[model samples]
Target chain A: MALLDYFLRSKEKQVTTASKAKERLQIIVAHERNQRNKQPDYLPQLTEDLLAVLRKYIPVTENSLSVNVDKKDGDLNVLELNIELQEENSGK
Target chain B: MALLDYFLRSKEKQVTTASKAKERLQIIVAHERNQRNKQPDYLPQLTEDLLAVLRKYIPVTENSLSVNVDKKDGDLNVLELNIELQEENSGK
Candidate 1:
């Protein structure tokens, strides 16, 4: 019985921290949604064009490419492109 | 001289297409910068906190994690989190 309680206590501690993190993320994510609604409509078009160009040189799927715009300063913004490269002929 | 011209023509074709893509990206990216300026200030903080949470469960580096908020519908927004996982004990 003591062993069961010990394991349960440890499991609860882990859950507590993880759930706290999730709650925090939910709040921040909600705020982010408000800001994102104001973004320009050109983002989707840009993503599609960039993906088409990248596909010409790299073997990438829709899941592997993401484009984002991050605010740097008052007037500066950074266009971030992420592409996950897969090994060619991976023998896995 | 004929062989040289053939190689030059092929190289020029490749360069022209790549350069055209680059120029298009540049123009769209410039427009994106303007829209990104209105994004909320909590993005960096949200990214850091999410990274910290992820580190507790996954072996990820700064370069492997990115968080972005993407607009979905008129009132909905999607918070995208990307983490590039590395193999454990890679026998390379």
Candidate 2:
């Protein structure tokens, strides 16, 4: 809501980038936050399987999901996922 | 770009949220990508120091900068930071 918000603006008018990225990133963040105990190893397979399950109800695009592990934390392993879920209208 | 883009839209008119979030997240992503080998532990301190140094020339808000490590990736510690830089006009 202020002029200073656009310090990173670069003329790209993709309005939904932030919201979508936020949605995806939040999922990843939450997932990472929750799985700090088990240290899930089959993330790639897990994401692929989850994507398949999600596609049954909503259309999802390729590369719209990102799953990774970040070990910057000393003892905690973060399981992160960023997914773009298609609108229900786009589904059926 | 299309109608499906707003699947997560909830009538929040903050058009710059996604753009700004993306900008900040991209910086974090890039930072994490670069430091995969060293497994930096002083990221929060580093980001704080970086913010302090940046404040000399730019106006950055508290909580506008986020520094964290995501351990979702095995063997790679991702250093993540999201910073909102105030516009030059607002800075001066």
* Residue range B1-92, candidate 1, lDDT tens digits: 22223323433454345322111111101011112134443434534554554454444556655544543222223344544433233376
Clashing pairs in 1: none
CAPRI rating of model 2: incorrect
- Candidate 1 interface RMSD, angstroms, 1 decimal: 23.1
lDDT of 2 by residue, B1-92 (tens): 12112211211233234332321211232112222233334434544554454454334566566555555333223444445433223356
Top TM-score hit: 2
RMSD of each: 25.3, 19.4
Cα deviation at B53, candidate 2, in Å, is 2.6
Tens digit per residue, CA lDDT, model 1, A1-92:
22223323433454345322111111111011112134343434534554454454344556655545543222222344544433234376
**Model 1, docking class:** incorrect
Candidate 2 residues A1-92, lDDT tens each?
Answer: 12112211211233224332211221222111122234334434544554454454334566566555554333223344444533224356
DockQ per model, Cα = 0.02, 0.02
